[model samples]
Target: MAAPLFLLAPPRSYTSLINAMLGQHPQAFGLPELCLFNVPLLKDLWIRASDEMSNEAKTRQGILRAVAEIYGGEQTAATVKMAQHWCAARQELSTGLVYQEIVERLHPLVAVEKSPSYTISLERMQAIRAAFPDARYLHLIRHPVGQCKSVMALNEGAFALYVNAIEFLEDRAIIEPQIAWHDLNINILNFLAEVPPELQMRVRGEDIMENPREHLAAICRWAGLRDDDEAVEDMMHPERSPFACFGPINALFGNDPNFLSGPTFRPHKVKFPSLTKPVPWRDDNQGLKPEVLALAHEFGYQ
Candidate 1:
């Protein structure tokens, strides 16, 4: 298998678009959020065993979509069944083992993926490393203010609560999403510290979206993949990726359902917010807390 490339970021950080874009590269196969590490057994992905919150279903969409494309050459109910059988064949294998098998099948082309859920646990990432010690990682970051606002906007901070993402569940009972935003980013940074510099690259998501051609070329160069104009143009068409459109009914997505429904890339410059000012999401006049500011600076925001 080619060296696995992971896109690391907290949820709602534009990881979906970025991952799709990178996968669209001619020499890369961008897989959906396989989310295999969430479980030890591959069968657990198909059995909806819990009445409570379990994201196991997240595994199906990616696999189904991949099967539809790689094996069946189309995403239809028949192809979805084919995907089921493919997964069933690997039911006894560990998630990483199954994933590596897929990667191996796509050999000579790098496999690109981003499972936002992976950032929830340091152990999940460790499991990825344990499987493929030579895997490469892209530590993608967004400004805390932007990341927090996006997270809260989606399901009222449900993402935050799900990950127990907050750094400090404070006595003040303030809904400080910056706490989760800062800490999860810190989790990625701290975990990545042990990885060799050659195996990792950090890119600001805002930069990629705003100046995709330039940034994509930089990333391609870093990954040691082709950085020619044709390759860059192909990466720009992330919407062309099989998983970019509607997924099979059995597995709609490991990405944003909305994104799947209408995945298109448009160029626009992202405005960086001021760290010293009150954010629009917060009702009070209070600005970003000192700790949040520090974290923003760490990500190279002033």
Candidate 2:
């Protein structure tokens, strides 16, 4: 069985689109956000990870969708039910072993997966490394301003709060999403430090959005896959991926709802917001913090 390739990024960082695009490759199988690593055991997924957000139900959706498509031969409601039974039968298994079963089932085709939730905790990421030591990782990044803005736009930065990314002032505390953005990237960087250079890569999300053909080809080459015109052509339609759409009612999302609503890849330049401007989500009319700006600058943003 081939080790899977994981795309690492915080939520709202274009992970869904990119994962589908890469999965659309003829030689690859793209998976829904199988948040397997979010918990150490299979049963933990059914337990609520936090009270800050109601994100627990969908945690199993990705894995169910994957199992239905890979084993049950379709993603219909009945098949999704079957996937649930499949999980129940193996409730005592380790998450790593269960994940490996999916990977092995899709042998000869590289599995491409992304679960932004995986970056919420270092232990979650470490779980992945332990499962597949040779797994390749693509540390996909977005501009801090753009990423943080998108995070706030989605459910009012619930993701940041879900991970306790709060900034405390002398009198009060505010949900500071940049803390999650910076800290998640740092988690990935620190984890990758021990991984062989050839097994890890970093790509700017905007770079891939604007000119995917070039970046996609480079990624395919790095993964030892075909980079011919036919391969590149296949990647242009992420909407064609099997897991690119909302699944049955029982398994509606293994990805961002905003993205699953429309998974198509339309090439265009993503406008970058000015770093010095006040963040729209802030009622205080305040700009980014100095620490946040410093981190953004390190990411090559002016």
Candidate 3:
């Protein structure tokens, strides 16, 4: 079985675009978020991680869509139904085994994936390494301000709230996405510490957005894939990916909605906001926390 390349990052870190871009490589297979590691068993995907708004349901949609596309060779209502049955058939199997089966099916094609939820707990990440001892990891980072802003912009930082990244003020607990941003990155850093240096790499999401061709070529070289113009050009057209656009209603969201709405890749510079400035996400207009700034700097951000 081909060991896969897992992109590790928190949500809203350009994971969707980057994953799609890398997946479009001629020698690679960009899969929608499998999120398989979030659970110990294949059946657990249907179970909530907690009483709060865990992303298991939405995450299952992505896995189902991936199964539908990879197995059914199509993602239609009927295929999604088939995917449900597909998952049902393996409900008793270990999630790691199911994941390996997918990797086996896509052997020789680098399976590029990122499930931000994987960073929520070290156990999820550990399961991945245990499954693929030779797996490669990519630690993708985004500036704290930009990442937190994007997180808060979506449903008032519900993901942070779901992950218990909250701060208690005098009276109420408000979502603090900066906590999630910092802590998730830390989780990735800690996990990567145990991985062999040659088996793991890091990239800045902003740099990739600015110079996708060069950065992508670098990634291709590192992953032992083709770095020639032919493979590189294929990666540039993320919109060409099967999962780039919205799928049928039954499996519409195996990816980000913003990405699904406009899956095309535009090579433009991302004007990152200042780190110390008042963050737009907070009504109090607080700047980044010291911990957030420290991690951002460690990631080569200002």
Per-residue lDDT of candidate 2, residues 1-302 (tens digit): 98899999988889999999999999999999888888777878876744413578777889999999999889999999999899999888999999998899999899999998888777888899999998999999999989998998888888989989898877899999988988998888888887899999899999999999999999999988899999999999999988878888778888898988888889999899999989876778888888878878887788
Model 1 C-alpha lDDT per residue in residues 1-302, reported as the tens digit of each score: 68889998988788989999999999998888788876777887777745223455565677767866777888887888888889888898898888888888889899999988787778888888888899999999998888888888877887787766543333434466777777778778877987889999999999998899999999999898999999999998889988887766666666776678777898788888888889776666777778779878877998
TM-score of 1: 0.91
Q: Which scores higher on TM-score, 1 or 2? A: 2
Q: lDDT of candidate 3 vs native?
A: 0.88
Ranking by lDDT: 2, 3, 1
Question: Residues 1-302, candidate 3, lDDT per residue (tens digit)?
Answer: 77899999999999999999999998889999888898889989886644323455777888888888999998899999999999999999999999999999998898999999999988889999999999999899988888888998887788899889999988887898999998888899889989999999999999999999999999988889989999889989999888998878776787788999988889989998898899887777788889888888888887
Q: Once superposed on the true structure, which residue ranges of model 2 sit more than 4 Å away at CA?
A: 49-54
Residue 273 displacement in candidate 3 (angstroms):
1.4
- Worst-scoring 10-residue span by lDDT in model 1: 165-174
What candidate 1 gets wrong by more than 4 Å, as runs, is: 47-56, 166-175
Report residue 286 deviation for candidate 1 (angstroms): 3.9
After TM-score superposition, the amount by which residue 76's alpha carbon in candidate 2 deviates from its true location, in angstroms, is 1.0
Give the higher-TM-score candidate: 1 or 3: 3
